[model samples]
Target: MAESEHSSSENASMDSIEEHSKQDSELEFSDDEETLIIRMFNLVGERWSLIAGRIPGRTAEEIEKYWNTRYSTSQ
Candidate 1:
């Protein structure tokens, strides 16, 4: 029971996708973003847009729309 409560509290702390991100995670990425981003964007498709700071000048709205459009069509 204690463990379950702890896990729930941990999950609650993740207010947004930002929760999944940490400064350390950024360091894990290679300096060569171009080569890496292409593969990620391909796999994630429109969802890639939701990822902040992935590409300069790409707004959250634009990314959200891209993903929502894809999501609606698939449904």
Candidate 2:
């Protein structure tokens, strides 16, 4: 009886952990994608030249070319 109770508790904990892990993974993925889209928009939207300046080693021209390529392929 004691062993059964312990086993049940362990199972419950494991199930909870698994559920939380799944939720964490989903939230992380969504946040990452949202961040990427926001960055791409901010880079290409108004004040683009300033943002391009903010990121060293990256030029507005190259960024524009990258976006154009992405736009062409995504369609």
Candidate 3:
């Protein structure tokens, strides 16, 4: 009984981790979202939270990272 309970818990933990990874992967922005982000950046400057608000399911940090990777110049 104890071993079965432990196994169940481990399976649940693995499932939870896999679900989290799936959600993270699903967060990738589409082309329309990227265009919106660019337009929002023009309108709101670096207020990433505001930009994210316009784009559903996106967090400020994610939007900022995308902006930096796609738009910022390397120095």
Per-candidate TM-scores read: 0.29, 0.42, 0.63
TM-score, cand. 2 vs. native: 0.42
RMSD of each: 11.3, 11.1, 3.5
List model 2 lDDT by residue over 1-75, tens digit each: 999999999999999999988744533323444455458676667444554565555555644554455454566
For residue 3, model 3's alpha carbon misses the true position, in angstroms, by: 21
- Which residue pairs collide in model 1, if any? none
lDDT of 3 by residue, 1-75 (tens): 999999999999999999989866755789999999989899889999999899888899989887887789985
Q: Candidate 1, residues 1-75: lDDT per residue as tens digits?
A: 999999888778765556556532433434454454545567775555545367665555654554455445565
Among all candidates shown, the one with the greatest TM-score: 3
Which one wins by TM-score: 2 or 3? Answer: 3
Error of 3 at 49 (Å): 0.3
Candidate number that wins on lDDT, 1 or 2? 2
Candidate 2: the clashing residue pairs are none
Q: How far is candidate 3 from the true structure (C-alpha RMSD, Å)?
A: 3.5
Put the candidates in TM-score order, highest first. Answer: 3, 2, 1
lDDT winner between 1 and 3, please give it. 3
Clashes, model 3: 0
**Residues forming the 10-long window of minimal summed lDDT in candidate 2:** 25-34
